[model samples]
Target: MLKKAGIAIGLLSVLTGYLIHHPIPAKVPDPWLFQILTDVLAFSELMGTISERVGINRWWAYPGRLPVPRWMNVPEGMKIEKTVFHGIESVVVTPKGFAERKIPGPAIVVYHGGGWVFGNIDSYLPLLVTAAEHTGFLVMSPEYRLAPEHIFPIPFEDCLDTTLEFMSRAKEFNVDPKRIAIAGDSAGGNLAMAVTVELVKRKIAGTLVQVPAMQALIYPKLQMTNYLLPSYAQNREFIFSKDLIPKFWLSYIGLSSQYSLAQIICENAHIDFSNKQMAEKFALVHEDRVPTRYKQRPYNATPQSIPSDVKKLLDGKTKAYLNKMMLDERIAPLFASNKTLLHLPYTHVLVCEYDPLRDDGIILFERLQSLGKESSLQHLPNSLHAAASIGPFDKNLYHAKQNKILFEKVRDYLNNMH
Candidate 1:
């Protein structure tokens, strides 16, 4: 009995040591707790890799499939329900006494982020519930389909369809059609922007009835063409490392089998910057649009050589297919023209200094300003990626504080729209 107890204690100590020493590059205000969470995330990823080798290919989707407990506590002053909005599985949260309002209330449709692969509405309960209580706006979060199963257009379609159907039936939900806003973070933020741009196009074509009041994107990964932006290098090892993002992007677009392509992309050799037309297509994401303060770390634009096998692989159909997909405006809204952007509604962009996608948000805000569009930017110098979505699940006091600040800022912006 004594020997067995010693073995168990020894194993526990080893695990505790590994988690404590896990390398998290970002100097977040809450270091110990963040390290624990990062290890959890990395372990999930490692399991996905191991499962793939063993032919249990869908293990990555396990997180999305896990049951969200029905008894999970709702935020104070909020009421929550699981409902279907136009055939999409969703979660709805409304503030108490919302039904008694004399006027039709505002509503916001939020898409949850899990890098296009795993997050579901259940995982985002705290974020949605808090937003409902703080903003008094009816909040609807859709359980969009996951990738490596549904792929790009399907997830995008679900978000767009849910938004359109919600608008057309706003009276049923007691919402003002013109007062609804669309918002999301990370991959969901990418979907929100794409959906917003599509709505603008439909309006121009005399097809859209109710345009969204505004779009709020939180640290969205906007473009796949340029991964060498200053933030990619400056905060590469921050919560979401430079090496991991490409894998997410590849998996989303049904290109996971082409994993070797990640190397070509990180080096910025996938698209030829020398070609003026291609350069012009991605002009919005250029490093020049990023501000001087953001470029604190020196960035080298020099191209790195691709391995012989990868170079050979890219010389055929994969090359053409990738270029076409990367430049598709529907997939990468940052590839949209000035004319399309001018039609967009007021925009709020939130970026964190230690996020790898920081430049994506800043450049987007800069482009919107150049088009004379109404836009606002909120930059959190001490925060890391995924801070806002940490919401009520935050274990540390500092993350909880940041989550409150983020939601309150978003709430104030949406309220002003009214």
Candidate 2:
């Protein structure tokens, strides 16, 4: 018994040591920082074991539990207010100079990202404060409800309401109703894009309300139907793709319990195409869409011609869950009509080379520009997804140098916006 106890204690100590030595992501550069951060933020994979054992609607929010160094904290001197926009409570950050301005200033509504299952307005304090301060714009971030509870169209519609309401009352916040832009990272980008789609639809009704002046999408997950994008193969270590994608997808569509089965079905479904139309559609994101350099052997680079075991699990119920998201342009703005996108504002899309969603951003940028819409695309070849959230405005060295450059570029893009 004594020897057994010692062995157990020894193993525990090793695990504790590993956890302690697991370098917390800093603003400075660390070779293992991205890999380590990916592990910490991969709540889906972290919870996968217990997920099958327990019957719960949700697990804890990852990334949020991680330390956000003091430097990443929202800046001081920005006056933050609590207000209701379109009946939904919102957190608004403004500059002290708002009182002196007679003309409405540029404004932005930043949607926080957490795979659409996690995060809130408060979770994005740094981005809000930084954007408002650097770009000299009033920042309003909506506390849109999350999925698996509030569900799909609810979150997207909430953002749409916030945009319409915020645009209508720009004078109240001393913001130029016409200069307003929407910005979001990850799932929030999905919302921002959907809002832009809504704005286009509304514009058709009349020429009364002006649409957003610009949209800044930071590595958004645009297409759910195509998971075999080049980035998905190159960045297989991406926490969201390998660790969390289908889990969040199923949850958003109210299929949290069937995640394991749904994940299999979805994964296989992407590679399972019998129709000629489907094959051509999927080919749009093939090697041609990828930059030459990102096309490499590290990923399962072969065309997804062979189906996985997921096909065996597909059933009527399974198809229903997949269709729940696959069918809605609101869930996947990649399906938005070209007519709706033609009227979208000048777009600034940021794609990180090491992110699975890299192709998504590139495709969206190409789509908008091809339609004659004004747009810009920035490729961060050295950075990873959510790099903007790293080292918040030079708090530490984690990805400090990279983030500073990206954030400054974003500010410059916004400053130049009409």
TM-score of 2: 0.84
Stretches > 4 Å off in candidate 2: 1-10, 16-36, 64-76, 205-208, 240-243, 265-284, 302-312, 393-418
Give the winner by TM-score: 1
Question: Candidate 1, TM-score vs. the true structure?
Answer: 0.90
**lDDT string, candidate 1, 1-418, tens digits:** 9999999999987885664454765557676666665676666665666665666553363455555553346766677788776698888788887766788788889998877887788777877876776677898888888887888888899999888888887777778788888989988889999999888888888994677898888888788888878888777665433546777778788987766677888877778655576778777787888989988766666666777988776775776677787887667888877888999988888898878889999999999998889998888786778777554655356666765665666667666764
Q: Candidate 2 lDDT, tens digit per residue, 203-287?
A: 8767577788788888898766776666776776545435367677777777776665544533445343654544555565555
- Which residues of candidate 1, in runs, are more than 4 Å off? 1-21, 54-72, 239-241, 272-277, 298-302, 393-402
Per-candidate TM-scores read: 0.90, 0.84
